[model samples]
Target chain A: MIRLGRKHLFEDLPRFFASLGGIVFAVQLVVVQLGIFFGFVHSSSLLIQESRADFWAAAKEMQYLEITLPVPYSWIAKARAVTGVAEVQPIIIRSIVFENSNGALDYGRVVGFDPAGSLVHLDDHPVGDLREIAKPGAFAADAGQLSSLGVSGIGAEGTIRTKKAHLVALVHDTQPIISPTFLYTSLRNAVLWSPAMIDEFVRDPFTSSFDINSPLNFVLVKAKPGVDLVALRGALERALPNSRVLTKAEMIDVTQRFWVKRTNVGFILGLCAALGILVGMVVVAQILYTSVNEHIREYGTLKALGIPDRLLYASIIWQAVVMGLIGFIPGLLLGLAVAGYAQNARGIAIEITLPITLEVLGLSIAMCVVAAVFAVRRAMTIDPMIVFKA
Target chain B: MNEPRAVIGDSIVMTYPSAAGPVHVLRGANIHADRGEIVLVDGPSGSGKTTLLSILGGILTPASGRVTIEGTDVTRMPRRERACLRLARLGFVFQGFNLLRALTARENIELPLQALGIRRAERLKMIDALLERLGLADKGARRPAQLSGGEQQRVAIARALAGGPVVVLADEPTASLDRENGAEVMKLLCELARERETSVLIASHDQRIAPFADRIVSLVDGRC
Candidate 1:
């Protein structure tokens, strides 16, 4: 049956490809939209998803990683007392404005932590000169946002919240999805720039003081090996009444859900992906039905040859499948290429994972199958006796 | 010598729903064809010759009557069974030659064998032999549209007889051919009927091929 259908396509090459063109475009639509959707899901919670912490402690009522309020710096010690707790790294998160060379201000999130023991990465490299921030004018920020984050250049001096700051080193792959830029420096420099956090008793970066009452934004924690995170979460929740406790996985999920519900990125991309599939299905069906309609006499000839409806249906389906399979090859390659371009040009990371590959292939074939249904009806309804007429 | 009847029909009746009412196309039509015989049925337009051929070929079911091929009463069978009977025992050549325009002459001839699920190598051999026998050996790779009308009819005849059916049903088998081409097609049909003992029933408006037929049945106003 497939052989017959293929032969037919060769005889009517122009019409066959005209039909194939619609399905190919459909494949591209489904692939590109699905790729964009994956990008949105990943970038929404990148910080939480990339961290090495087993558990996270943030201010009570905090719904996301990027929008944290300060909690008592002493909450780290209180959390460490829990049975499964092994280590805690106190951190501060604050929104600050960077003064561009022109003195124009650009807003970004600033993160401060003990550089020697921080779990979050600065472009997958260890922070150089961990003690440099104690100089009162030194800090490191992602370089990808030189324009967006309002940084002048590498080794350029700048100010954050009226405090002198230096861009000692630039980082990569650390651009926060929600904020235009990110700053990572020693806890002392981050405090000087964040006056609100300073008033709330931030831990002094220079003094090795565990008793400092600074208001830290978060605590990154590691459970003892063999400890269940759920149990550890319950323990931390009980120990620190003023903070929210969550496992790293749960925090990632929470952050993603918040962004999806609170922002329109997820819903918009999701709707587009669904629309792509629906449009692809309709376009392919139209192409197939039109081809069948044009070849009614050819189908009638097959019927007169004693070919049953089942084989006829199989032939039509096989024709669609051939077109779909050919179209998907380019669609997948071009879609991934576009995703790569978008990531480079606009800083959006679109990932094509194993499940998505299988899903889109299945979707391509399924749409072709669905498209053949209209043709099947026309083929079966053809009267074989039409060939007997003049 | 009298040969055994390969096809038989008795009192066949057919009616179609029209804008006005049911129009009876075949009423009390009877036809028969013996082994090694070429039967011709000629009539004017709307004489129901084509409808009678469609019924005897087992494609169109009659309102009432029996159509028997090789002693099996196909009208009593279900649709699938009747189709199976057609696939294995009957062949048809239509007015337009009815070759699949997509396939070459050889591929068209192999179509019926393909329906029977014949092996590829075997089908090719059968196609090759038939194309040679029909004087189209060199034209096997040409599509129906690429061939002349006479060549196209020969290809259709090759396709119909490729499976060695019990009988061949043709409707206006030479209507579109030139006088020379029409005579060639008639000669081939007669030779195939006699040499293979395959019966042939033709419904046509052209009387030029009548001298080749072993029997003639006239149909007028849906009765024969």
Candidate 2:
């Protein structure tokens, strides 16, 4: 039976390929749309992965890194006193508008960290020199920002008049460090340039928000080896009632849920993919239906010769499956090519996992089976006596 | 005539229900064919010759009466059962030379064997022998579209006989061919029946084939 199925498939190879052209085109549309959605979700989480932090302590109800408030700068000293805590650092984060070479304004994140502290400078990538940022008005920018600024190396100078700062070293492709256009500067410069910075360190007389003395948006905490994260989380949650301390995994989940899950992007992309599958299925069903109709007399003849309805049904299904595989292979390859092109041209990362590829192929084949089954209803109803009448 | 392999119908009455009313296609039609005999059913168009042949071949069920093939009552069986019996014991050649357009001559002949679950090697050997015998050995690889009317008929006949069925029914097998091609096809049908000892039944108005039959059954106004 398998051999017969193969023979029928091979014999009708031209028809199968012609029909598959539609299926492949449909599948590619769905895959590429889904890939774009995935790329967006992945980009949102890029910073969290690059941070390489064990835990983040943020004010209650922090949705993403950019939206959170800073804890008191002195909290670093108090946190260091806690047992099992390796180090503590204070950092300032703000979003500001900067002018491009074309005089167009673009929004970006500005990060201020202490040059000498282990907590502020956590990246493993080599920074030219610590003293460079120590100079007044000096700042560092990510490669994306540098490119957008139409500048060449770390020595290129650019100004953020909104923050009254000057760029010094340019960090290339440091994604999570600053998502949009991150500019790094010294803590002293951060405090001096921005009007939003509070001078008192203890309290803010104007705002009634959480403790004003808190100097960092999050205090990254690393536990000693062999320590249970669950147990430590429990202890920390109890100790710090004013803030939330979450493990790396928990933070990732929170970020994903808050950002990716709530966004309409995934839903829209998924709907597009579903529509593509539906179109492919319809195309297959119509092609099979027409093919069966065209061979009605042949079917009658076979039936008159003692062939059972079950075998007849099997033959029709076999043809469909063959067409599906033929269509799917090229569809899958074309989908990958489209995704690769999109990623290169638009700077979008589309990750093609093995399981995902297999799943797509399986889905395509299943669609073919469904289409074939639709045609089987007509094939099985053909009367063998039609041959005798003819 | 040799021993009878088919007792076609006993007082068979077939009525088709159309929008107008019940139209009787066959009335008390009886046909019998002995082994190795060529039974030519002669009738004008719409004279119920095809209907009687259909019932005899187990391809149709009469409103009343029964058709027995090789001692099995097919008309009394369910439609699926009748179909299976027809496929196993009877083969048909239609007027259109109904070879599958997508299949080659060899593949068309192999269709019935495939349905019977015959192995590829065995079916190929049988197809080769049948093609050689029909003088179509060089044409087996050609699709029906690539063959002439006479060649297509021969391929259809080869397909019908490939399974070595007990009985073969042909409906106007020479209707689409010229006189010369028609004679050739009739000769092949007669030769196949004699060589294989199978009952051959042909329903046609062509007088050229009448001489090849061992018996002639004349059908008129739904009666034979």
Candidate 3:
């Protein structure tokens, strides 16, 4: 049966492959949609990678980074006091109107960090020195903001009008999470620009002073080697009753779950992908079943020549498997191509990695085998005696 | 004549289920043939001539009685075992040539040998010899769609002989060919039967092939 299976594929592969265009297209749609959905999920967690912090401490019940409550800046000092604490950086986050030179206005995040903070500068490439950011009226614009705001060159000057800060450096990292029209300034400069922020928190003694209009959102923490992360997290959670402590990996997962799993967008896209795969399976089954019926006499003739039903059944399955493989190669390649084009056109981060591509290929082959089983059963049950009847 | 290489059935009776009732297609049909002998089965339509041939060839099982080929009781064997016997010891030339449309002449001839599990080198050798014997060496690479009707029939004969079976059952083998091509095909069947000492049983209504058979069994109303 295996030998016959091989011959069957070798003899009929060209015709089989030529007839599978519809199935391939259908499968490709499912795979590409799934890829883009995964891409969106990755985009929502891009901040975790860009921040490069070992751990994050935020207010308890934080659902998303953008919406989480600010913890006290004093927590930075307390966290740094821990035995294995390598560094502690405070990050203040607030949204403001971004005005382009042409008078077009957009909303973007304004981030305030200490000049020497590790959270503000990426470890791989430091865009601006701590001394540069500490200089009065100095601020840096992320590359994504420079293009969106129509500002050009490294010394491009732009204003964070609401905070009255001047953009001095154009930091080049096209990462959308960090660079999408964000204003980066030193913590002192931020307070100087908006002096009312200091008094507004100081007057409210009952409320935490850090809980002002422009409050601290996160305190990025780096831990030394051999420190038990779980133990550290438990200790921090006890000390800061109003805050939630999470390792970097946990924070990334929370971000993904918040923006992707909990959102309706993932559901809609995932449903469409599943429907596409179902359609592809139906198309393949129908075509293989019809081909089997059309070639009944041939099957009977083979049977009459002493070929067992098992061999005949294998031939039909081999044909289907060959069709699937033929369709899958092109479909897999085209799906990735479409994903790449969509990512470029929409400027949305869609991850289409090698592992995902291989997974889709394996999935497509399994679907083909399942469909072939249905068609082959129909072929095998045909009585050999039919060939001799008149 | 040599010893009877093919044994006739012993009071074979076959009944088929019909919408109206049970329909008996063959009733006590008997046939016999010696080595290198050609036996012609002739009857009108629905007279069970083809049915008798099918039963004798181990393709259709009888409700009662028995069929023996070279002393093997094919009627008593299991379906798959009987099919294996048919493949190993019997050959069939179907009415319509029944050639696989996608395969070329040589590939079609090589099919039976492939079923017999012959090695590739040996199967190709037999296929080449058979095609050359049938004067179809030039047409070996052409598909059935590319060949003439007579050529297709010849390929069917080549397929039957490829496995070197002891007996050949030809059902209206030349029904679609012109007189000249028909005669040529008949001559090839007779020649192969004589040279290889293979028993030949041909079921046909064509009187033209009557003179070529060594014995003629006439059937009527499902009786012989």
- For each prediction, how big is the interface RMSD? 1.4, 2.8, 2.8
Number of the top-ranking candidate, with DockQ as the measure: 1
> What TM-score would chain B of candidate 3 score versus the native chain B?
0.95
DockQ for all candidate structures vs. native? 0.57, 0.49, 0.33
Whole-model lDDT per candidate:
0.79, 0.73, 0.74
Q: List where candidate 1 sits over 4 angstroms from the true fold.
A: A12-24, A126-137, A195-214, A225-234, A242-244, A278-283, B1-5, B71-73, B76-78
Weakest 10 consecutive residues, lDDT, candidate 2 chain A?
A: A200-209
Q: What C-alpha lDDT, on a 0 to 100 scale, does residue A317 get in candidate 1? A: 91
Of the candidates numbered 1 and 3, which has the greater lDDT value? 1
Residue-level lDDT tens digits of model 2 in B1-224: 55446656678899999999999988888778877889999999888888887788777778998788877888778878876776677888889887777678998898888877789899999999999999999999998889999999999999889888888988899999999999999999889878998888899999988999999999877777
The most accurate candidate by TM-score is 1
lDDT of 1 by residue, A77-107 (tens): 7877889887888777778888866687878
Q: Each predicted model: what fraction of the native A–B Cα contacts (within 8 Å) does it retain?
A: 0.57, 0.76, 0.37
Interface RMSD after interface superposition, model 3: 2.8
lDDT of 3 by residue, A1-390 (tens): 444445445555554554467567766886787777777677666557677578888877578766665566567767787767788888766666666555666566666788676665533454545357677767676544555666664555445554445566655443443224566667766655433344434222234344555467788888777888777777666656667788888888888778675668788877887787777777778777877777778878887777666667777677666667778778877887887786556555556678877777777777777877877887768776677654
- Looking at model 2, give its docking quality level: medium
